[model samples]
Target: MTYCVGLLLETGIVMLSDTRTNAGFDNVACYRKMFVFETTGERVVAILTAGNLSVTQTVIAKLRQAIARDDPEHSIMRAPSMLDVAEIIGRTLNDVHVAVNERMERTKYSASASMLVAGQRLGGQLRLFLVYEEGNFIEATDDTPYLQIGEHKYGKPILDRVVTPETTIEVGRKAVLISMDSTMRSNLSVGMPLDLLTIRRGEYRVSTRERIEAGDPTFSAMSEAWGNALRDGFLSLPG
Candidate 1:
């Protein structure tokens, strides 16, 4: 399992994903869950995936092939709008989910995966979508400016209390990092090394992209600070 979150705010979009995959206690490894496709100032799309590795990898590979071939009808970079891009991704994810599940039937394993789609096209509005296993998705709106997948429950409270459609891009990044920190602390399956990116509104390009490795000083410091703050807050609460 993994944890991925995307926030769509007035100023921009912030997304983060963990790089952990585990089949068992002894069979654990790191695999990036974020994929980005950008045409600099023309268009940009970032996908954060969570679920069966085979299904997610195949879906990403096909998406990349479409771009490499310049398939106008299918390439996300060529999609007329962010909505169209979400539709394309949804359809592809659904197809791959079904195909892979059939082959895994004998083992009773599921090939289902979900993804968060966030991006903007030149002159288009910034948009975010959470695509489900069935190929359908829901957009993030003002009432709920964020979407999360995988080991999400442990990390959701901070987002619920702090994030809003009007949140600043910098704050959004911090909130996501703290959220991921909380999830990693509570879940053994979700481990180190994280992918983070941000796209400013109207830029049509990624503004920041970073990978926070295990034991990075900055992240470790932030995590420790947050933990201390939480402890103090709990102690201050009335019994």
Candidate 2:
């Protein structure tokens, strides 16, 4: 399991994902779930994946291979717009899932993965999409300027209450980190270090990419502040 969240704001897009993959109580490891592709001032794409590790890795590898070929029809780098990029990713994820599941059928194992894809191309509007296992996706809209996957329930409340299409990128970053912090406290399957990426409107490139590891002072301070605020609010409620 994992927790990945992406916020779409007027200023830009903010995305974050944890790096923990647990096969069982005794088998736990860290693997980055965030992948970014960009050509400065031309285009930028970021993918946050969650679900079966093998399926997700294979899907990413295939996407990379397609880009290496520089084939406009199959490469996300050559996709005309962010919408097209999302479609390509959706189709690839679905194909990989089917192929892997077929190979694992006799063993009774399941292979499935979902992803949050967001980016922009030169002269195109910034877009964010949630791609499901069925080769279909939904785009983020003004009414709901965010998308989440994996153990999303634990981190959704803050986003619902604090995020908005008009929010600034700086505030958006803090909001997402708080959202991740909430999930980390409640779920053991999602842990540090975390990958965070930010893209500003009109830049056509990723402006910030960070990794927040365990014991990181800035994140730790934010987490503590949020906890204290929650307690204070609870205490102020009439009983």
Candidate 3:
């Protein structure tokens, strides 16, 4: 299991993903789940994924290969618009999902994968898409400026309370960490180090990228402080 979340705010986007892939009680591993493609000042896109490692990794590898290809037909970087890029991703992901699922059937393994895509092309508006394993997708609108996949239940409350289209970049980043902290406390399958990024609107560049490890002092402090505050708040709540 994994936990991945992305927030599109007024100033930018905050994305985070855990690196855990659990096969069984004794078969758990870590793999980076965040990816970024940026052409500073022109295009900036980030993908956060959660699910079967093979499916997600293959999807990413193919996407990267497609974009790096010389043929315009396969390059997502040359897409005319953000919508086109998203459509391309959806189409490719769906194809990959089908192929991987076919193999899984014989092996009796699950190929569950979902990804959150967020980015902007120079002349295009910032857009965010939640892409499922089936290849279908939905964009984040002002009404719901965030998306999450995998082991999300434990961390959703912070996002519901503090994230919004108008939220500041700083706040969104903090909120995501708090959300991750909540999930980490509840799920052993979701562990550090966490991958995070901030893409500022219009800059088409990633402003910050970080890895929050198990003993990162700041993260540890934040998690402890958040927990203490929650405890105090719970005690003050009306019965």
> What is the per-residue lDDT of model 2 for residues 1-239, given as tens digits with 9 covering 90 to 100?
89999999999999999999999868899999999999999999999999999999999999999999997887999999898999999999999999989999999779778999999999999999999999999999999999999999989999999999999999999999999998998999999999999999999999999998899999999899999999999999997
Q: CA shift at 119, candidate 1, in angstroms?
A: 0.2
C-alpha root-mean-square deviation, candidate 1: 0.9
* lDDT on C-alpha atoms for all candidate structures: 0.95, 0.94, 0.87
TM values, all candidates: 0.98, 0.98, 0.96
- For each of the candidates, the C-alpha root-mean-square deviation to the true structure, in angstroms, is 0.9, 0.9, 1.2
Q: In angstroms, how far off is 94's CA in candidate 2?
A: 0.6
Which parts of model 1 have CA positions greater than 4 angstroms off? none
lDDT of 1 by residue, 114-151 (tens): 99999999889999999998999999999999999999
Report the alpha-carbon TM-score of model 3 versus the true structure.
0.96
